[model samples]
Target: MPRFAANLSMMYTEHDFLDRFAAAAKDGFQAVEYLFPYDHPAAEIRKRLDDNGLTQALFNAPPGDWGAGERGIAALPGRETEFRTEFAKALEYAAVLGNDRVHVMAGIVPADADHARCRSIYLENLAYASASAASHGITVLIEPINTRDMPGYFLNRQDEGQTICRQVGAANLKVQFDCYHCQIVEGDIAKKLERDFAGIGHIQIAGVPERHEPDIGELNYPYLFDVIDRLGYTGWIGCEYRPRGGTSEGLGWIKPWLKR
Candidate 1:
C-alpha cells in the first residue's frame, strides 16, 4: 500500500497551523507535508511533528514574494542571489523538520520572454540547488504544474520535467509528479507514471477538474494506487487537494489505505 501524507497547506483548514499536526495524527496520518514553513520557527514546527509522532514528508522552498503573486524565482533570470538565500532558509527548515524532499518551483514565464534563456537559467539554478542540498542529504524537486491553474508557469509536461532532470545531471535533482496537474495537461497518467518512474522523486494527487479528495474525482485512485504498488514505489503520496467539506469528514476515501 502507498503511504499518504496529509497536506497541511490544503487540508485540515479548520485547525490552526500548529494544531493541524495533532489533528492529522489523530486521523491516522503518519506523515504530513505543506507549502512553506517560514511563518513559524523551525523549532516550533519540529516540536509539533515530534509531539504528534508524525514524519515530515515534503515541503516547497520559498517562492519569491508569494503575497505579490510571484510563484518561484529559480527560472527567472537575475534572481539567482535571492533564490540561493531562500533555498538556504528552506534547507535549514528541512534539517529541523527531517524531510528529504524539497520542491523548487519554476517561476512564471512572461508572454514574450525568451524560452531558451529561461531554460538555461532554470538548469543552472537547479544544478546549484542540487549541489548545495546534496551535502545535507536532501533531494531537490521540480514539479510540472498545469497551465490552466497556473497560467504561464514555465514547467508543464512530464517529459519536459524528466528531460530537464536528465540535462541537469544531478542525482539529487528529480521531478515531483503531481497527478492533478498531469491529468489536466496530459491524459496518459498510468503510462507516464511507468515510463518516468526512475526520475520521479515524489508524487501528489487530487481530483480532476476540481482539486478535491482523490476519491471524489473522475480518476480511479484505487487502480492508480495498485499501479503504483506494482511499480514498487515506496515514497509518500501527498494528498495535495482542497476539501469540498470538512477536511477530516472527507477523509473516508483514505481511511482504508491508512489502516495499512
Candidate 2:
C-alpha cells in the first residue's frame, strides 16, 4: 500500500528526536527511519515504537568518526573488523525493533582507495553482513549517497550498488534506494527503480533543492507514490527531509497525504 515513513534524524534542530516520531504519529505516520540509534538502546527505541504503534522502518550502521566528517568505514581496508563489529551492534538493535532492514553505510574513499580496492572491501563486508543478518531474517541495505553531500563517498549510484549486491550474492543484501540522493546524483528515479527493483529493499525521499515538505518541492510524490504503488513496491517510503519548523508547523504541507 506504499506505506510512508518519517526519518527521525531529519528533524534536527526543528524538533526533538522523539517528538518527530510523536508528531509523525499524530500526522498519521505509522513508520519511521533513523540514521543512527546506537546511542539509544534498542529496548527504549522499541518501546517508543510499541507505545505509538510506529514500525521502525530502518536505521544506518554505526557511523565512524562522524564529527570529523567520516560517515562509514565499510569499504575501508583492514577495517572489516570495525565494520562487522558495528554491523553486529546494528543487528542487535534491529532485532530489538524487529526491523526488516539495516543500511550498511559506505564510507568515504581515501585518496588512495581505488574502485577495485574499495569494491573488494565493500563486497567482502557485505558477504559477511548478509550471512549474519540472514540468521535474524533482517536484510542489509547499501545506500548510494550523493557526492555533493558526501565528497569521496563510495557507492554513489544505483548501478554500482546493484552490481555489488550481485557480488555479495546473498539474499539479505540489497539496495537501500533513496530518491532524494538519486535525484541529485542520478536523475530519472522511477526509471532507475524499474531497472533495479529486484535489488531494491527500501526507499527514502526528500524534496529537491529544498528538502522540505513533499508538496512544497520539485518531486511529484503522488506520481512517485503512484508508480511505486503500481509496481507493487511494499517497502517504507521514508521522509528524510529538513523541516522548516517543528514537525507540526511544516507538516501541514503533507496534510493531503495524511489521509488513511
Candidate 3:
C-alpha cells in the first residue's frame, strides 16, 4: 500500500500549520506536504514534524510575488539571480523540515519572453540546484501547471516537463505528477504514469470540474489507485484539493484509499 499525505497549504493557512499537522496525523496520514515553508520558522516546522511523527514529503521552492505578477523565475532570463536566492532560501527550509523533495513551481512567463531563453535559464538554475541539493539528499521536482488554469505558465505538458528534466540532465531532477493538471491538459493518466514512472517524483490528486474529491468527479480513482498499486509506487500521493466543506468533511470520499 502507498502512503498518503495531505498538502496543508491548500487545506490550511500558515496560522493553522500546527493544527493541520496534528489533524493530518490524527486522520491517519503517514506524512504531509505543503506549497512553501517560508512563512514559519524552520526550527518550529521541524519541531512540529517531530511532534506529529509526520514526514515532510514535499515542499515548493520560492514562487516570486504572485501579487507582483511573478509566479516563479525558474524559466525566466533576468530572474536567474532571483531564482538562486529564492531557491537557496527554500533549500534552507527544506533542510530543516527534512523534506525529500523541493518542487519547482513553473511560473508564468511574459508573452514576449523567448521560450528558448526561458528554457536555457531554467536548465542553468536546475543544474545549480541539483548539485547543491544532492549533497543534502533532496530531489528537485518540476511541476507542469495546466495552462488553462495557469495561463502563460512556462511548462504545461508532461512531454515538456520530461524534456526540461532531460535537458537539465541531473539525476536529482524529476517531474511532479499532478493528476489534476494532467487530466485537464492530457487525459491519458495511466499511460503517462506507466511511461514516466521512473522520472515522476511526486503525485497529487483533485477531481476534475470541481477540483474536489475523486468520488465527486469524472476520474475513477479506484481504477487509478489500482494502476498506481500495480506500478508499485512507494511514495506518498498528496491530497492537494479544495474541500467542498470543512477540510475534514471533504475527506470522507478518500477514506477507502487511505486504508491502502
Candidate 4:
C-alpha cells in the first residue's frame, strides 16, 4: 500500500494547528502535510512531530498575502524577489522539520497580464526555487489545482505543470499530482498516474465535486490504490480533503488502506 500523509491543513481541523500533529498520530497516520507552517515556530512544530512520532511529508511555500486573495507570487510579474524570499523562508522551516518536499504555488494570473509573460515568470521562478531548494536536498513540487476551487489559479493542468517542470530543468523540481483536481480538469486518473509517474514527486487526493473523503468520490480509490501500488509509486500520498463530518469519524476509508 502507498504511504499516506494526513493534510494537517485540511484534515484534523477540530484541533489547533499545533495539536493536529498528535491528532494525526493518534488517528493512525504516520506522516502529515499542511498548506503552510510559517504561522508557528519551527521548534514548536518540530516538538509536536517528535512527540507524536510523525514524519513531515510535505508543505507549501508561502503564497503571498493569502488573506488578500494572493494565492502565490511565483507567476506574478515583478514579484520575483518576494517569491524567492518566501522560498528561502520555507527552506528554513524544512531544515528544522526535516521535510524533503515543498509545493511552490504558481499564483493567480492577473486579468490584464499576458499569458506569455506569466508563463515566463513562472518558469523563471521555478528554476530559481528548484535550484535553491536542491542545495538543501529538498524537492520543489508544482501542483495543478482545478480552477473551480481556485478561479484564477495559474497552474491548472497536468500538461502545463509538466511543461513547466521540463523548462525549469532542475533535478529537484517535480509535479504534485492532485487527483481531485486532475479528475475535474482532466479525467483518466489511472492512465495519467502510469504515464506521468516518472515526473511526479508527490500526490494528493479528495472526493470529486465536494472535495470530501475519498470513499464517496467519483473515482474508485481502492482500484486506484492498487494501480498505484502496481505502478511502483513509493512516495507519500497526501489526504487533502475536508471531512464530511468529524475528521476522525470520517477516516473509515483510510482504515482499510492503513491496514495494508
Any runs in candidate 3 off by more than 4 Å, and if so which? Answer: 12-15
The best candidate in terms of lDDT = 1
* TM-score of model 3 vs. true structure: 0.95
List TM-scores for all candidates, in order.
Answer: 0.99, 0.94, 0.95, 0.98
Task: Please give, for residues 1-260, the per-residue lDDT of candidate 3 as tens digits.
Answer: 65678889877443367688888787777799987788889998888889999899998898989678777878877887888898889889987888889987767988898888888888888899898889989999999888788899998888888888888889999999999999999889999999999899898988997787667788988788889989998888988887777777677876776665
When summed lDDT is taken over every stretch of 10 residues in candidate 1, the lowest stretch is 251-260
Better of 2 and 3 by lDDT: 3
Q: Pairs clashing in candidate 2? A: none
Off by over 4 Å in 1: none
Q: How do the residues 172-254 of candidate 1 rate in per-residue lDDT, one tens digit apiece?
A: 99999999999999978999999999999999999998999888767889999999999999999999999999998999998
lDDT of 2 by residue, 31-85 (tens): 9888898777778888888888899889888878888888888888878888889
Clash counts for the predictions, in order:
0, 0, 0, 0
Query: How many backbone overlaps does candidate 4 show?
Result: 0
lDDT of 3: 0.85
lDDT ranking of the models: 1, 4, 3, 2
Expressed as tens digits, the lDDT of each residue in 158-250 for candidate 4 is 988888898889989999999999999998999998988889999899999799999996989989999999989898999999999999999
Q: Global lDDT for candidate 4?
A: 0.92
- Cα lDDT, all candidates: 0.95, 0.83, 0.85, 0.92
* Steric clash count of candidate 2: 0
